[model samples]
Target: MDLNHSINFSSSSSTSSPFDDFIPLDSFMLPDCDPHLSTKEEEDDEAKRSSFTQLQKENIDLFWNQQLFEIQNTPVRKTHHEFPIARVKRIMKSDGKVKLISSETPILFSKACELFIMELTLRSWLHTEESKRRTLQHCDIYRAIRNDQLLDFLVSIANLF
Candidate 1:
């Protein structure tokens, strides 16, 4: 590209980046620009910057939330009105009360406690680093089910079915 085109591209590129675009290098008192002074001007600049950042964050969050909602709401074809064989096997093969929690993206459980322990155990285990203990202690699992956070996510999944 020509020098003029390259410079233009670079300037636009810095602005387009999600993180860096919010604050241009020069705007942060880079040696090239006239120093910004005065409390009112600084406050105004700060306000503008924060507002822009907030808008950007909100827009990005909304975009992902909508995308997730779309995916969550998408319909699936059922093969036989019976649960998929893989899912049935997965649930049946689980070691204990965990089987009560279904893999059906939208989960359903007859007992709240059954759903709670299983979902949290699955999520916590998956997020755990390999070096970390694979299983949570029994007390923690009991507490998690008591708190119901696990049940909530499970219900969200169950509702999908």
Candidate 2:
């Protein structure tokens, strides 16, 4: 019934607190203490960034050229209507506001999907050739997106960038 009697404050005694060893704010060195140091650091960073960007651009150009050469040398293959119609129908149904889908919609969607896959594969193959690798990687896709500014915008709008 007595609330004050149930609490005990002075049960243990430890003099040194955990934060006692911390250095004062005034004694800590500021990141930009020297103006010249910051300027030099910034210059170095800019140079590194520009060099990296140039390197990336060169790589992208090389890949693109290789893709062009391959395209010229390779024989054309016949297109097969392999896209799944059921999957396209399911996608069309995902929109709650649209209840009905035209019968031709699925065919168009399938063709679009095929084109999208082909484009992605071509871009990814370019990356593979750039890296001199046999298999494609996620980094290849990321680099491809980065190198293609238009694709970058599309990806950004799609929230994938």
Candidate 3:
């Protein structure tokens, strides 16, 4: 080969160049933008979300916060619960070291369990929505748990696959 060969600076043939195709920024789609390009399911999801009034949306969006506020302001009750207090008591007493549990313990535990469940489900539902999925899968729960540092204790139980 020649020591000082000149590199070709031009294409003589009619084959199209890679950069010939112009891609405008508007051509690229993003979430919740360009509704005309959205699928039926996406439209339905949007409609559902839009159906909620501003106040309802605010309450839903700040569910955990609102729940904490209500708990702090409300008086404690001993009326058992929607969740069976007896079952909660049984589960608590299942531990070998648990010799005695106060009457109030089961009521509190049952309420706590209900609150925990609602919070976790809300978080997992958010993950499902983020993934643009209507169904709440196990992975959503795992993702929710992984995303929150406080839920790290559940990470071992909810293995990411």
Write model 3 residue lDDT over 2-73, tens digit each, in one string. 337654435766765444565656544644565655587788887765653343345456996888898899
Sort every candidate by TM-score, greatest first: 3, 2, 1
lDDT by residue (tens digit), candidate 1, 111-133: 23343344566434433322256
Weakest ten-residue segment in model 2 by summed lDDT:
1-10
Q: Which candidate number would show the highest TM-score if scored against the true structure?
A: 3
Better candidate by lDDT, 1 or 2 = 2
List ranges where model 3 is wrong by over 4 Å. 1-61, 72-75
TM values, all candidates: 0.26, 0.46, 0.57
Per-residue lDDT, model 1, residue 97, is 58
Please give the ranking of all candidate structures by lDDT, highest first, separated by commas. Answer: 3, 2, 1
The 10-residue segment with the lowest total lDDT in model 1 = 105-114
Q: Write the per-residue lDDT of candidate 2 for residues 1-161, one digit (tens) a residue.
A: 24456544553566544344766666356554666568789889899768766765676577568757865796643343557777779988998987998877787678667656666666766677657899998777777666676587656644454
Candidate 2, which segments miss by more than 4 Å at Cα?
Answer: 1-80, 153-161
- Cα error of candidate 2 at position 112, Å: 0.6
lDDT of 2: 0.68
